[model samples]
Target: MDEELKKMLVKILENQEEFKAEIRKHTEAITSLDEKIMQRTEALFDGYKINSEKIDELTDKIDDLRFDVNNLGIKTLKSENKILELDRRLAK
Candidate 1:
């Protein structure tokens, strides 16, 4: 009966050690996962910042194009008026 009790006690201690080891492994895994999550979050924010800058640049370019088009329209109107005046002079 004594030997049987000793064997049971030893088995319980071995199981306790295995449980501790498993808990350590799980803790390490959680820590690693947390680090990875932080890295990915930082990367996502960086991408967003880059995209926002690009959008602002594109908007500025569009504004420049609009200004050029407006200037061209005004020049065209002036040229038409000059041509009409020349036609009137020729008629006289």
Candidate 2:
């Protein structure tokens, strides 16, 4: 009976060691995944920043183009008026 008890006690100790090992493995895996997630999140933020800057630059360029187009339209109107005035004078 004593030998049987000893065997059971030894088995329990072995199982405990296995359990600890498994826990360590899980902890390491969780830590690795956390690090990878942080890296990906940082990369996303960096990409967002770069894209935001590009958008601002494009917006400024579009504003400048719009201003130039408005000026061109005014010039076209002035030219048309002058052509009409010349026609009136020739008719007279």
TM-scores vs. true structure, each candidate: 0.74, 0.80
Candidate 1 versus truth, CA RMSD in Å, comes to 2.3
Q: What are the runs in model 1 whose C-alpha is more than 4 Å off? A: 1-13
Q: Rate the local accuracy (lDDT) of all candidates.
A: 1.00, 1.00
Ten-residue region with minimum lDDT total, candidate 1: 82-91
Kindly give the stretch of ten consecutive residues in candidate 2 with the minimal lDDT sum: 79-88
Predicted candidate 1 versus true structure: per-residue lDDT over 1-92, tens digit per residue: 99999999999999999999999999999999999999999999999999999999999999999999999999999999999999999999
Best by TM-score: 2
